[model samples]
Target chain A: MREAVAVFRKQILDTRKNRAVLIQFIMFPIMTIVMNSAIKVDDMPEFFYLKLFSIMYMAMAPIVSMSSIISEEKEKGTLRALMMSNVRPASYLAGVGVYDFQCCLIGTMLMSKTCGLDDGPWWRYLCVIMLGLVISIVLGASIGVLAKDQMAATSLAVPVMCLFTFLPMMAQFNDTIAKVAKFFYTQQLYLALEDINNVKIGTEGLIIIAANAIVILAFFVLAFRKEGLTNE
Target chain B: MISVTGISKSFGDKKVLDGVSFSVEDGEIFGLLGPSGAGKTTLIRVLTGQLKFEEGSAMINGKEVRKLTGADKKKFGVMMDDFGLYERLTCYQNLKVFADIYGVGDEEIATVLREVKLEDAVKKEAKKLSKGMKERLRLARALLAKPKVLFLDEPTSGLDPQTSSEIHEIIRKRKDAGTIIFLTTHNMTEAEKLCDHLVLLNEGKIVERGVPKELCLRYDHQKRIELVTTNGETISLQMDRENAKKTSSQIAEFLKEGKLSTIHSKEPNLETVFMELTGRKLEV
Candidate 1:
């Protein structure tokens, strides 16, 4: 447990060192929210664009942060060094995931504020951010394990992030797409947040969030089991 | 003590290590001398429990290295050629992290950094340090845990001569302090200076094993004798044991005639012995 925290602290320090990560953590959310608001469609409600903006920011954060963890460590050979230290695979993953998840959560908070989401019940907003960040972190960690390098990680993550982002956007346009996007993790978070804003704690909304969390948690465990045992 | 018996490793179809066997006694510096791609690094990795061999077993301190648990792993220190340091971390922080991982205290970190002569630069980030400083920092980290066995693979590969000597001095000190060192180096001089015992590895097999002087004598039969004449002309003679009596007679005649000025016998170095054993030069 102490080793995990040391590794986690190291990752946080490394993230702090990277200027681009800082910008992605801080500026991107602010920029996304401003852009979404500036181009609000005439037929669309104000809250609709804000909700979409929050979901996009939440989804992007995990992919970028998680991919960077593996690629940067692999590049520096830090992962190899850590492996040499005899750190357990589970602890290493937890350390890296926690750091990335923290980044995602921070980004989610900034995006929520920029979208003027303060009027909603605070606990629901917190739950939505937490759920979205966890799912994105799992997906990001899976990508980190699979990608070979920084370029490879980005190349793979861009399409996945785009797909997730586009799924919700597609749901906004077509009822058929909405039905399909309901199966996506971020879509579940989006619906849950929308329901919370309407003060309607629908049983389906609760189930969707709980089910997405369980599935992602299971995938995380499975992914760690598969790729975490071997040191690259 | 570390004992490796008939260990072999292959990546895909290419065999990297082939039935290599050796043992390292406690409190002795054991050198693995070989050319590049001779499986020196792979062999070191296996002994240090960082890699698993396809065949054979390595017993480190009476326990199979491959089967070492987390507690057992903390007893060994390793420094490969690639000293994967965190660039953003200060020298102190880097050492601190490893010390923490090993559950050692801050005093050990200070002691190690001081031993490696990095005390002054402990506060400086790794990326800002020079190459020699980086190597020292790596050495410091490796020694921080007070490991029972130390594995060093080309530990001084890229340093300047002065810095290399400094690093070697620290290694010698460690060996003197009763740490069993498993060292792999292509530098024959390093092997000659530090190794109490050595194994010459060629293509993953032990080609030669013994004390440096003994191996030199066993493989290189012809001795190079250089004599300077009174007229300042130098005469060289290669003498085998069978021809030594005859050569001594000739040298005695030269001395009697007041023609001999200086005399010295030249035995083969580790490099020559290595070439004689492996049929190749140590390339880097």
Candidate 2:
């Protein structure tokens, strides 16, 4: 537990010191909030802009933040220091994961309020948001593990940002793309946000959630194995 | 405190370390001296359990390296090829992070900083530090855990002579404190000055091993007497150890004729020994 805390404290220190990453952390969520407010138009479905912003926030923020964080560590060789130390893989990952989740949750709430989405029971609303954000965080961490540096991570994140955010937004217009997008976790998250109270969040939502969890875990193992994490 | 037997490691089909073995007793400084690509880094990685070895075992503190657990990691500190500093953080923050890992407190952190001469720069961001200061901070971080065994890879590789000398002094102080050290360097002078035992690694093999002076003597070439005459002429004459008596009579005749100004025997050094054994210069 102390190891995990240490990792957490170091992550905070590093992230705070990194202005590029800190700017992204602040800018993306505000972009979501501002974009939602700018597109506010009469006759629009209630909370329509909110849902779009939430999807964007859920998908892009964690990927950009987490990937940049881990890849920068690798590039700087700080990850090698952690690997050589007594800190276990799980402890380090969990520490970073918790931080990613907290940031995404804050973004979710900010977007929700800025778009004037009506609140249901707070716990149910939060649980749905938290679950969706975890998937994004895990997927982002995988990108981080694969990236060689911050620049590489940014290049890779561009296409991923488009795939997760653009695809779901595109699904609203194209029928065929909607059919394909339905299988993506980001798409399922948009659907869950659309019906926060009425949707079961059990059928397709559960399936995509379960599948992403497995895929993300596998991605971590494969990427970190390439990093020579197996010996430790 | 550190032992290895028949340790060999390969990357894909290329054998990087083949049948290399050595042990470092407690409180002794052992140097793994070699040129670039001589598998010095590879051997340290294998012993530290960062890389897996295919065909041998490394033990530290009576426990196999591969089998070492969390608490076991506390027994040693490693300053790997890359000194592994968080350049964005202040030096104190860098040391604090590692201090947290080793379960140490503020007092120990201050002591380590003092030991490496980094106390005044504690608040300085690591990237802002000069090269020598950065190396000193790296040493400070490595010593945070008060490790029984320390592994240093090219700690003074790129530093100037004065800085390198200072780093060497810190290493010697650690040795006096009874910490077993495994140092890897391409610097012959450093090896001669700091190492009590050393192995000459050449292309993934142990080409030679022993004390610096002993190895030099073991590979000693024929002794030569160099003379600087009063007429500003320099001359060298080989004197076989077995023919000392005959050479002594010849030297007396030269002295009687006032032909010799000064004469001294040219004994070999670690660099000469490395060149003779590897057929290559230590740095090149």
Candidate 3:
């Protein structure tokens, strides 16, 4: 636990020193709120703000910030330094997870409050948003492990951001896209957000969230193992 | 303080280390001298518990490497070929993270920073540090825990000669203070100057192992002598045990005739010895 906190503290210090991560963490949600306010649509859908907050910006921000964190460390050999220390894989992952989740949650809250998109009481909405954001953070971590460097991570991240952002944002308009989006965690999150008045999770919602979390988290474990997190 | 027995490692069908074994005494600097493909880094990795070997055992302070727990791990430190610094953190911050892990205090951090001559640059971000400074910071990190055993892989590989000498001085000081050092380098001069005992590795096998000067002398059979005459003429002679008497007679005759100005004997150095054994020049 002490080692995990050290890794977490070091990761936080590193993230602060990184300009690209700073830009992504601070700008993604702010851009969402600013755009929402600037482009005043006459007949905006009630769930439009939800999609912007959860799908377009909140989801994309953590992926950009967290994925680059891992890839940058790999490229710069900082991760190798951490591995050489007494830091275990669980501790390292937990540290990174804590930082990424906290940062993403803060961004989500800011977007929700700034856009006045608070559906129910803050706590209930926060719980649901956090579940989806966990998926986003896991996806980011998996990208960090798989990519050889920041450039490769950015390449992997674009498609991921697109799938999570556009697939759900545009699903309301297109039939085929909506059908495909149904299987995505972001789509389930979008559906959950659309009905903020009654935010009880159902069987399908539970399955989708669980599946996304499991598959991505499993991929993270496999990628880290292949990268020799335990062996060498 | 460290021992390895019959250690072997293979990457698929290509064997990188084969039946290699050596031990390092406490307070001694042992060098693993080899060319690029000689598996020097691999041997260091195995000893440092970073890479697992397929056969045999590596033990540090009488504790087997494979079974090392957190407490056991704290006994040693390693600086890999990559140096592995957090480039985004400041020099002090970088050391602080490791200090926190090792349960060390600010006084130790300051001492190590001063030891590596990095106290002035403590607040500088690592990415902005010069290559030489970066290497010093790495060495400083390795010394942070006051480790019982230190594994250094090509620690001065790319530095200027002066900086390399500075690093060697710091390492010598550590040895004086009773830290066992396991160093790997392709630099024969570094090995000759720093290592008390060294093993010459060729393609993952121990080709030669001994004190550097002793090994050089053992292979000094092809001794050559050069003589300059008073008339500015030079004579070269190869001396052997069988012809020693005749060579001395010839030299005496030359001196009596006042034809000899000066004479010198050339002994084989570590570089020549390495080439004679491996058929490859040590990379500069």
Q: Which prediction has the highest lDDT against the true structure?
A: 3
lDDT of 3: 0.83
lDDT tens per residue, model 1, A64-125: 77876776676666776777787776788788888877776777666667666655565577
lDDT (Cα, tens digit) per residue for candidate 3, span A1-232: 8777888898789888778887777776777778778877889875466555666655787788778887877787767777677777678778887887887788878877776755564566678888887888888888888888889999999998888878887898999999999888888877876766566667998898799889988988888778744224
Clashing pairs in 2: none
- Lowest summed lDDT across 10 adjacent residues in model 2 chain A is found at A223-232
lDDT at position A209, candidate 2: 76
lDDT of 2 by residue, B238-263 (tens): 78878778778877877998988889
Model 2 DockQ class: medium
- Per-model lDDT: 0.80, 0.82, 0.83
Task: Score every model by TM-score.
Answer: 0.90, 0.91, 0.92
DockQ of every candidate structure: 0.58, 0.67, 0.61
Best first by lDDT, ranked: 3, 2, 1
Clash totals for all candidate models: 0, 0, 0
Of candidate 1 chain B, the 10-residue stretch with the lowest lDDT total is B74-83
Off by over 4 Å in 2: A35-40, A114-122, A195-202, A226-232, B227-264
